[model samples]
Target: RIAWLKNYAGIDYMVPDPQNPHARVINPVLLNITQGPPNVQPRPRQNLNILDHGQWRHLVVGVTALSHANKPSVTPVKVLSDKITKIYSDIRQFAKIA
Candidate 1:
């Protein structure tokens, strides 16, 4: 995965997701969670340098596959300011990114 990302998208060889980690990167939080191996963790994601420049109008995460019980959890991306309460139902669910 690292090789492919480096070759194709040109992502830096450092940690990809600062919040998550894989075999290629060690994360302190993950170590505490599993007490060891990451097999119990979410599926590791290969870095996508193509999305690097922060130019994507929409950031799409997760797979289209039937909600895999073993993959990463669907996280809520903040689409509005914290002060803005009562977001539309559809937007809060991440469906707006679609």
Candidate 2:
């Protein structure tokens, strides 16, 4: 996934929504939640050169596929904020360059 991000950074990929489709760049928070190894804590998005720029305009997160049959839990606003914060912070140092 990181490799994919590296190749497509700053490009707005389509997010397939039923009613209204949207576009978003990949981010560490969404990557951790959807693609990280099972049961392992996801790492912070640091040293990732591609993630240093572009503001997130939408909330939709793109995933390769769903692994479980059960529905995902609803995320609280605070936790979601933290995740986004961490992701942005990890890439904050490179915001100017990206």
Candidate 3:
């Protein structure tokens, strides 16, 4: 996973922090994108050609977190799809209100 991250995700170097031995610190640039409300639709799985590293990471992390949050019953793919639908519905409602 580390090699894949370094090669494909453009994460050059990840080293253990001097102060916190257990914590690893990656290149600052990889942490450029801030956490916030969802701003873009996750790239469709059928379209695996999308080269946006940030979006890919976002989708993977979001899906993983959601799956973990509702574990032991809900499937990961189902959770991700349901979340995507809900996000779109919320966006539409917000737009209507605005």
Best by lDDT: 3
Give the per-residue lDDT of model 3 (tens digit) for 1-98.
44754543324456567789999887454455455565554664455323445655677665455334424376767656665665556556444442
Q: Evaluate model 1: give its TM-score.
A: 0.17
Better of 2 and 3 by TM-score: 3
Clashing pairs in 3: none
Clashing pairs in 1: none
Which one wins on TM-score?
3
TM-score of each: 0.17, 0.27, 0.31
Q: For residues 1-98, could you state the per-residue lDDT of candidate 1 as single tens digits?
A: 44643443223344445455553553222333235463555677755443243522233222111112112354333312211232233245653343
Instruction: Give the alpha carbon lDDT tens digit for every residue of 1-98 in model 2.
Output: 54444332321233344455573344323444455575565675434445433425232132211211112353444444544665567667867652
Error of 1 at 55 (Å): 13
Candidate 1 stretches with Cα past 4 Å from truth are: 14-56, 59-98
